[model samples]
Structures are given as C-alpha cells and as structure tokens.
Target: MLFDLHEAAANRVSTTQRRNTTTGASAASAMASSLTASRANGLGGLDTAFTSTEDLNCKENLEQDLGDDNSNDLLLSCPHFRNEIGGEYERNVSFSRASAGSPGGSECRLAEPALSTYRTNASISVLEVPKEQQRTQSRPRQYSIEHVDLGARYYQDYFVGKEHASYFGVDEKLGPVAVSIKREKLEDHKDHGPQYQYRIIFRTHELITLRGSILEDATPTAMKHGTGRGLPLKDALEYVIPELNIHCLRLALNTPKVTEQLLKLDEQGLSRKHKVGILYCRAGQSSEEEMYNNEEAGPAFEEFLSLLGEKVCLRGFTKYAAQLDVKTDSTGTHSLYTTYQDYEIMFHVSTLLPYTPNNRQQLLRKRHIGNDIVTIIFQEPGALPFTPKNIRSHFQHVFIIVRAHNPCTDNVCYRQLLSGQTLPCPHCVPEHVPSHCSSHWRNDLLMWLLPH
Candidate 1:
C-alpha cells in the first residue's frame, strides 16, 4: 500500500509541473495579445487591457488549482514554495472563490482589478481625514441643564419652616440666615452616595460704625494675641471679625424698623430676640441640686455649660472682652459669661436658676429664655421633647433642639467631650451644633459662616 501511494504522488507531481509550464506560456501569450490591442486603441485602453488580462490570468490559475484539491496541500508541504508565494497565493485564491460564489461576481471582478498592486502600495496611499471632519467627530459632548432635575425647594420651606427646623440652628436675631445646601453624586462614598456643599448666607444688616470700631480695637489686640490657639493671627482675625459682626448685627436687628420687618417676614414663627438663649432641661430632675447630682444627666449638663462659656487660659485677654463688657464670675455660679468671636453669650442653665415651689415648669428659667429670640433646648438622651408650644413664649421664634450624643458610640460626641474637658482655648470658641441630617454640618459652620 505504501509503494502504491508513493507511485501515485510522483505521478501527480509530474502532472502539476507540466500544467504550470503550460499556464506560464498561456499567460505570456495573453499579455502579448492585450498589449497589441491596447496599442491599436489608446494609453487609457492600455491600462484597462493590462489590468483585465492580469485578473483573467489570476482567476484561471486560481480555478485550475481549486479543481485539483491536492495543489494547495502539495505547495504548503514544500518549504521553498510556501516561503515564496504562500501568502499571496492564498489571498488571490480567497478573492477568486469569493467573487465566483457571490451574486455580483462580474461587478466585483471589474471593481477589484489589480488586487496585488493595491496590496503592495497600500502604505503609500493612506487617506487623511479633513480637519473639519476631525473637529466634528471629536467635539465635546454638550451637557443640558434642562434635562437635569435639581429638585431644590424654597429656602424658608426647606430649612426654617416646620419641616426640617429640628435639624437646623436658626437665629432670628441674625435676620434672614439662608443655608443653600447642595448635594453632588459621588462614587467614592457609595454608602453615603452624595457629598454636601453648604453655602450659608447671614443677611444681617451691616453695622459700619460698630464694625469699624471693633476692627480698630480688635486688629491690634489680635495681632498681639499671637497663635496661642493654634490659629494664625490672620485666621484669628477672620474668626473674630465675623463673630463680632454677627454680634453687632444681632444688636442692629433689634432696632424697631428691623424688628418689625422680621416679625412680618415670619409671623407664625416665634418672636425675635436680641440674644441667643440656651436652656438646659433634663427629664425626672425638678430641683437644681437633684439635676446636678444625677450621674448621667449631670455630666452631660456640665459638658454643655462648659462648651458654651468654658473659661479661657488668658482671661480678659481679647479687646472684645472689654468691648462686650464680658465679666467672668469668680464664683462661677452666675450665668456663665464667655466671649466667642468677640460676641458675649450668656447661657441660662435651668438647674442654676432658683427652683420655684411646686413649679416643675420653672418659670424663673423660662423668663430668661422665653424673652430671647433664638433659644437652644439642651435635653438629655431620654428627656421629653421640649416644644415651643409648651414654653408659650412669643419672643422665642426659633428653637434649636440639642440632644447629648453617646460618647461610646458617636465619634463627634467623644471628641467634643474630650476637647471640652482638656483643651481650653485662649479665646472663647463657638459651640459646634450637632446635626442628625449630614456629617458635613460638623465642621462646615466654621467654613461657611465667614464674612464676605
């Protein structure tokens, strides 16, 4: 069987060689005939005739090879032939077979003449795209504002109104305080999902005379004060100026004209006050002694008091202390007086006031806070909700509800407790208002409340 197979293969090889010789001779004759026809016509006709003859030769050769199934296998097996014409031969065969199978065989053959010529010179004939086309194709995408739903609510309706008043610290004395809280979608905070941007506008009437005086006195004092509080003199000035401005603005807002306008602005809300009053109320503690002596409530209450008007290292050091007439009590029994940002804040503690006989409501403590425009209600964790309706005070327009956070669980709560007890500032620092809405509120007040 091996001897017979060898003999058949040798015969096939001889037949293929003979056919190749004949095909070469026929191709030469066809080329000569085409050249003769082109000369009789024109130069253009010469190109057309040459292309047509070459295509015809390639097609005939491809068809002949295809008819003999063993031709490709034999050529590929021979290393010399495969290296010389394997790629070109395969491409031409594929083109020929595709044209023959397709319905538009004649059109394809005419359209795609001189395939080898095109393939060889493709690198030199690269088509360039026009600059205009490139500009149109690579243009930046237009983002439409109309398609974006911001879903922003009105300032009063969203913040100061009854809806989210619990989460915010609204001071009626500051006039119209607008908190423009914007949220942007963020991928980093997948759990939280959005980053909040707070832009707070304190629309208090400008006190040019008071501001000028405060700046003149405080500027020199602040420069001399140095960076004792870990803040630069410039930063300290920035902090002091805004606070003093707020203080003066609060006083200016109390003028008959501004007070009437404020009343008209929010009639249904609590009446305006000159000073921000804070009242500490604890559940199940009626007497001053009982409230201060309690384990859980006492510590939290003292912490809150210390936060408001904690004693500074340099007593009466700032010019604001003299300007605001802030007299630190030696006894520390009176309403704790502390100057924050040059503004004097007097915290009216419920326990410190005289407990009236058979009066659990404590009208004495109420007298001080009820008259104030903006009142902060500091309640223990399990304390009853101290509503504005219960106070029955017309002057207290805004109620800021503050609850003691669990020091073991809440990070801010723990930090605040530590800072209050250990870290005493040279200047009276403003108490940080804790918000349940967003964590951004913790430090944002210092940044956003800067005077423009």
Candidate 2:
C-alpha cells in the first residue's frame, strides 16, 4: 500500500535526530524552500558553519553511537544494508499507498539482514537574511543546509542474503515498508524567505544503515524472539511496554468489548461505553438525607479536583468506566476515538485508552490483522511527579496486563517508538519524504517546553 508523505517522512529521520545542514562556507544561510515556510521555526545559525573535517567528526560521532568501531566498518557495511543487482546496489525509492500497493513493494525492501553501522556526509550552508528584516528582528539571522552524510562500511555483517523477517517480540512484519525523513520547523525565519519553509528529501545510505539497525531492534525479533511456547500477546505485553500513566494508550484485541471501548462520542454525551461521575461524600453513616452532597456541601476546589479521580459520565447519567471508543473521521472517513482523560495521568491506567484522534484511527484503519496487538503510551499535560513507589507500582500494573492479554506465542510485539526519547528505526532503507513532511523540528522536548 502507498505510504502517507508525512508518515513516510517521520519514518526516515527518526524523531530523536536534530536535522541541521552545515556547509563548508561561512556565507549567510538562506531560508527554507517555499514549502517549508509553514513549518520553519527560525534560521539555524549558519554564519558559524562547521569545517569539513569537523563535519566528518559529527558523522563519526553518530556512527560510534550506533556501535560502529570506525569508518572502515561503515563502507563494508553499506552493500549488505542495501540490495544488489548485477553487482551494483539498487537505489530504494519512496511511494504513496497507492503506488506501494503494487509489485514494486519488493524493490523497497532493505538488503538482506540490514547494516549494523552507518555513515553520512551532510553539509549545511548559511542562509542570509536581508538587512531590513534583520534590523526589525535585532538578532543574528542565518539558515542552514544540513548535509547529514550517512553510509555503511560493512554490508555483510547483518545477513547472508535474501530478505528474511525475524519475529521480534512486538514488531510489525517486515514487508514493503518505506522510510523517509521529515524536516519540521523549530523556529521562525523572517529574513531571506518565508519564516517556515522546509523540504524533506531523500537521505543517503549512511542514514539508512543506522536507521535499519534501530528499526530491527524495534521489531519483535529484538524481544522474546525465539522459537518457543509462542506465548500469546498478553504475555508479550510486559516485554513490549511496561508503563502507562501519563499517556493515553492503545491496544488491539479480538474481543468486541475491547474494540467498542476505543471510540469518540459527539453530540451524544459519552458513547455507550463511557461512564461519568461527580465527586461526592457520604456525610454521616446514619442517614441518606444527611449524606454530603458535593454539589451543595463539599468544597468546590476539592470536587473540581475530583474530576481527575472519577470519570465524567454523560450529563446526569450513571457512572461509567472510562473505556475507549471508536468513531469515523469527518474528512478521511477513517475511524478513531477521543481520549479518556487529560494527558497528565493516562499512563496510570492498566488498559490502553485512546489519547488522540489519530492514534485511535491507527487501530481501526490497520491494513493488516495479524494475531498481534499494539500498545501506545503517552504523557499527560502537567508534570507527573515520579516517585520510586509510583514507578514500581506502574510497572507492576503493566506487567500484569502483558501476562494476561497478548496472544502470540513464539512472536511478541516490539516497540516502534518509545515515550521520552526519539530515534530512527533500523529496518527502513533511508529515503526522502516528498512535498508533505519537510520542515524544521527540534527533537528535545525540554527545548519545546522551557520558558523562552
């Protein structure tokens, strides 16, 4: 099937990476392409560009992090990561869902085994902002062209030949999955061009090699991945994801109850599955009329805070356990659900509840239905105090669910992405995202949340 441009972009670079292009010249940086204007944050100071050797060192640093011993290791590893035909390597291409649905999906496959190491030669040039604009801004202005050189040194280290899918504990099967990078805007640029224009183009082999290794780890083969009792999904859940209090979670199951619980309600109060309640207290054990009515007697602030403790039932309705709901999209006709609670405390729940409309739709719009399920973890808005006791408690709850729910025996689900950190998946062959997902984005969440 064809991949979405935005999804394809995210698949390429990994959310953990900071994509910055540095050129050899100290010339001023330029604005991102017109397409990137909407997403551009601001110019990455290109006036202070990296020298060529320094650039190489940056690439080396990334390689070392991926476990490569040296540059020699990168080249030898390239061929094994990418497919070869007639003694030459085949360049992988990106495709949309419609285009990918065809036979060429085989072309998108990574070279058998994938590379263990990667290298790249990315360069960034400075984009100059006009003086008139600069005066108005009163700050140093520069744009950048981050080359991001990526290639592998050893191709043979990963596999012998022929694409084979190892059953990682919790990964989707390695079929015709495409990979691409997305450049999201980190700041606004007002100098040379539109403040937020960027483009996501194809990445070199270096990025692809490293990305493949990361992806491999995320797949099921990296988990409880051996020929054995073939434990069902419930058992695998523990190994795949163990925490859930901050983010709304998603889990796919065969039961109707499980399916119905993941939806969104509109004008109708909560969907049939939802429950609500208002904080109230029993006054005196002696009489019913004497009971403390939160609406009339209890503290307002306390009752308001109680919203976090209890589910909000439909107006005047009976209390319902906040379950997941499923609904269709107004535009794409895709199905999704509303989140059960605010972001701060989603992980506290044992079961996966929908956090956003997109996540819920992913479950309902799945293209393939293997006997596997998916779990998504997210953090709520406020700071969730982390305590040793609470951490252990949360883990225990996750472990229990995994032990009871998953169905796969030999195969277990693996991680596509984890909560706090962002990184590239290793299975994908690096390529560029088209017109859809190129803009500047800063990976560090701290940078995003801190007071500017």
Clashes of each: 2, 121
Model 1 lDDT per residue over 1-452, tens place: 00122233344455554553322112323333444554565655555545565555544443222111112211111100111111111122122334422132221122223334222211111123323433332211221011111111123322332221111122333322321221122233556433322112122221101111122223334343221232332333334334322322212322445434433443322211124455655764323233323323367767656645553322344432211223443212344445433234444445554456666465555565556545555566666533232344435444344566662234424111101111111111223323332323332222111111
Compared with the true structure, what per-residue lDDT tens digits does model 2 show for residues 58-132? Answer: 443232111111112001111001111111222222223233222334333444333223222222112233244
Worst 10 residues of 1 by lDDT: 73-82
Candidate 1: the clashing residue pairs are 270-397, 273-373
Candidate 2 segments exceeding 4 Å error: 1-127, 132-362, 365-376, 379-452
TM-score for each predicted model, relative to the true structure: 0.28, 0.15
| Local error of candidate 1 at residue 171 (angstroms) | 33
For candidate 1, report its TM-score. 0.28
Question: Top model by lDDT, which number?
Answer: 1
lDDT of all predictions:
0.33, 0.22
Candidate 2 weakest ten by summed lDDT: 396-405
